[model samples]
Target: MYISGIGIVFTRGRGIDSFEKALKEGWREPSRTGLIPAYRVGPETLTDASLSKKIRRADRFSRMAVLSAVDAYGNSGITVNEREKLGIILATAFGPHTTTFSFLDDILDYGDANVSPTKFSNSVHNAAASYVSAILESRGPTVTLTQFKLAFQNALILAGSWIAEGRCDHVLCGCADELGMVMECACKMKLNIAKDGKINPFAFSDSPVSVPGEGSVFVMLSKEKGSNNYGKVGEISFSQNITRKPDLFVIDTDGMSAYETGYKDIINYDTVIAGYSPVFGSMLTGSAFNFAAAALMLKNQIAYKCIFQDNPFGAKLCVETSAKNLNEIYCIKICRPEIKTIVRLQK
Candidate 1:
């Protein structure tokens, strides 16, 4: 399947308008906070008429997914037919973060017997996917994936395979993550924070910790391409037994090794959109952030720079370039200590 269109709802740093403005301004002070970036969307972004009221009723992660899906579908300009074969593959590293914590609190305060059904229902990993299906009035297949940092990549792979298999005409694939007190506490315990409580991934300073942030991104995938806004979905690959240290993997390698092993042998692409930074923050749903960012770059015809840091295992590398040719292909490389993989998306 090909990636037809993409939509992103990130922390308030840069939307299409702000991104253009920053481009003209030379990207001097780009937003770097890992928190959920701000985004722009229409009032009709959500299909649920009660979404506005439900905003307070739902978890933050669910809200992000709902808002992002609306923006994505709007940008695609493809209306969903209830009877058409459609599917959804949603992913998240931390599912129902706020609700998870709230549920914990409830269990702590009132014990398991008094936990609210509302919270329990909303806390499921697939809640956001269910909401999206309901809002779109889609009765097609819906699946949720959770693979720690590989959640988004896994979802994309599934969506692509489903389309390739003729199981669905369209697949709405997305990844969403949110911050919560539990995450903050974990960061404090795990990372070596600076005086200001910021952790720079590039900096090997005493703090090897990454900052925390969250957002939701969506893409529409289809097998046949027409006059719609579309981006080429080149290829996806995965490798097990990476034989690389996790920290060194991100900083030392330009991600070239994974590309060479997985995608380079099959196809050659000109540009690569890196989704490393956003994923770097939590290392949980980092792939989602990178995938979404890369998709946006392909959709907007923009080049991007991917920065990696140095580690004891290897030398760090950052890639900075743009699409050089119209047929310029883009590849996404994902790796764990045990597995290394690559996915290719064409222009």
Candidate 2:
């Protein structure tokens, strides 16, 4: 399968150009106004006056997904001969939990019968996908898969299966998540919250720190190459030869997910390493963000410098942002010391 187009709504900004600008620039500190510092999306970024009536009732979670998915469809610039042939698949770890919290608020403040129907509707995990499909008028199979582990990579795997099974000609696969007050309190109590809001990928310590972050990313996938193609998503594997290195190894080593020390074994190879979790913040869906960066690199044939150059572990890091011949990139996410998900993209 090939990645024809990409749309992203993240902490820095929205759209593919914004993502590329973030990569060229280095890492920035996460927001600190809340109880737990996070990479929360600003209100201005989600403002779409043109589609206000279309998504008037969408909450922040839905807005992120809707806007990102919409951009993914438009970014592809492919006139769908049949809207029914285009499918939608949204992958998320925590889908609209903030809206769920608000719905609970409605039940607590008002009676059960007095709950807001609009809020209840938006609370469902599939609401975002529905909004995307409705706005795009895509009548194909729409799915919402939720998992705390490998959500985006697993979505890619499923997208491949759907294409092979002749379910649809194309699939709009995406991820949406948010950092609400309830979730912030939970992360504060449950995880090691980074005080300065900076995640060090090179800190391969058993005890890793995390600064919670949230946003959405969507990619248009199809078997045939489009005019504006990122690259071909060749292999989606759970287990692969770690010894076989690509031109670049894009590691999703955000401190929140796995044992950081586990990455020590994988980095011993000779391929140049890159990780962009610090820019987006730590989330189970963070691999999608890394995949976006890899896709941009593959499309442009350029290697972005590692966000933070302070490497104590002496891993082969890309220190300079320069033009390079990038033929293949392996975006790997380690759920545990043993479990690994690799997405291979080739030029």
Best by lDDT: 2
Model 2 ranges off by over 4 Å? none
Can you write out model 2's per-residue Cα lDDT over 23-79, one digit (the tens) per residue? 999888888889988999999989999899999999999999999998988898887
Against the true structure, what is each candidate's TM-score?
A: 0.73, 0.98
- Model 1, position 279: C-alpha lDDT score: 28
Best-fitting candidate, scored by TM-score: 2
What tens digits encode model 1's per-residue C-alpha lDDT throughout 200-292?
A: 333333324444556677778776773454466655556643221221122211221222223222112222223344222443555554555
User: Residue 247 in candidate 1 has what lDDT?
Assistant: 13
Q: In candidate 1, residue 146 scores what lDDT?
A: 77
